[model samples]
Target: MVQPLDSRQRNRYSRQLMIDSIADSDQRSLLSSRVLVAGAGGLGSSVIQYLAAAGVGTVGIVDDGRVKRSNLQRQVVHTVDDIGEPKVESAARFIDALNPDVTVETHATRITPDTVASLLRRYDVVVDGLDNFATRFLVNDAARLAAVPFVHGAVYELEGQLTVFRPGGPCYRCLLPAAPDEETVPSDEPMGIFPSVPGTIGTLQATEVLKCLLDLGEPLDDELLRYDAADATVVRTPLEPNPDCPLCGSDEIDDMDDIDYDDRYRIED
Candidate 1:
């Protein structure tokens, strides 16, 4: 049964309550949802901020790294005071400060195959703020097999992309079937961030998550939303599930066991 919202919630979410689609009942649903953000860097920073602000009942943050002075450029959730703290801990603190009604579970560990599915098992939605394609594929496979929704976002110099993947919808694998060589894939951390790149992508990702929770707007499940920060243009392209996709079709991957995401990071054939 959904819990009734108290006066405090009403006051906290007053502005959002004004939206016709997110009136009393929808606010209650948002208050009862659980979301998992897989990284605590640039993308994770903004994703965590908006989800907590929107009053998600439970927010799980998973990151194995500590904050550094350099991370402040785009990691909006962490401040200079938290420079040496672990990202999950810092993000938790930020959420607590913004909305005490939110319950944050901090996992100061990496997203390895052994822990991915188990960690993701309880959340209603998994937001992929991860930097590498290797781990993103692992998350995509786990969410697909578990029949959970995965919202994916990534930012390069001045470009980024966002998409949603669920049971019947196209997945990351449907878009990029095989992991590229380490040398060929771009690194998650850039020499210098444009600042707004992550900010833009993360906010759009949060919007998608909220839409999924409330079932209000159309999701980007069968399309890729790409942003070009320099020119401020967004292009939406249609996508379809690949019948031969190794992770979601005839040759579907059902679990993380058969894949090796370690140094080589390849799907086992």
Candidate 2:
């Protein structure tokens, strides 16, 4: 646990604290809050950088990928010289250089069902910067089990979607009852997303995480915000809690270990 910073630290964040919605205590909450960001790629890059700059106390980054030349296009934290370096390591270095006040933990491994629960239990909030449906579902279910809130974002082509999953609000499974067919869901390699797509979505994820931590404004709780960068239009839609939602529904979930992804998502051969 991190103790609150002294007057010097508080002075540094004074401008932000001035916002009526976020006072000194809220700033302290941000400083003491811990966030776990999955995937240190495009989206994670922005999420991690912004949160660290905002003085988030502890940030945990999980990524098995290496910084590639291709990633430099969107992953602002990594430069051409960083190519071939482990993403989590690279991200941690960037955060440290940006703000010594933030303590960063790097997990240079892929997130799997066996590891998700334990990883989620360590953080106050989780940011879904993952690119695949499989991992997204894993994070969502794990966060629900840990009873922690998560902000999710997805980017494909020029479009992006973002939402917040509060304990009582609708979980991601409610909106995406089933993962898209593997054959239909394009991989980041082939899909070739625009750099700005995840940049925008990831920033929104960071914003929501800060708001949630500080108990600030109206969170997306039961709503999804979609952005069309080409048209510069954002559309908001309400998400209703599914009575049958296996993860956060009315039905009792006997055990976290018992929840199966295959039953929830229709994966095609």
The number of the candidate with the highest TM-score is 1
TM-scores of all candidate predictions against the true structure: 0.95, 0.92
Report the lDDT tens digits of candidate 2 across residue range 1-269. Answer: 64665888877787787787776677778878899999998899999989998989999999999998988888888988789999998999899889988999888887887788878877999999998887888888888878899899988789999999978788988988778765676544446688888889999999999988888788888889999988999999989999878777755665466765563233222
Q: Mind sharing the TM-score for model 2? A: 0.92
Candidate 1, 174-214: lDDT as tens digits: 99888787677665545556888998899999999999999
Q: What overall lDDT, based on C-alpha atoms, would model 2 receive against the true structure?
A: 0.85
Residue 158 accuracy (lDDT) in model 1: 86
Model 1: residues with Cα > 4 Å off, grouped in runs: 186-192, 258-262
Write down the lDDT of every candidate, Cα atoms only: 0.87, 0.85
Best by lDDT: 1
Worst 10 residues of 1 by lDDT: 258-267
Residue 158 CA displacement from its true place in model 1, Å: 0.9
Clash pairs detected, candidate 2? none
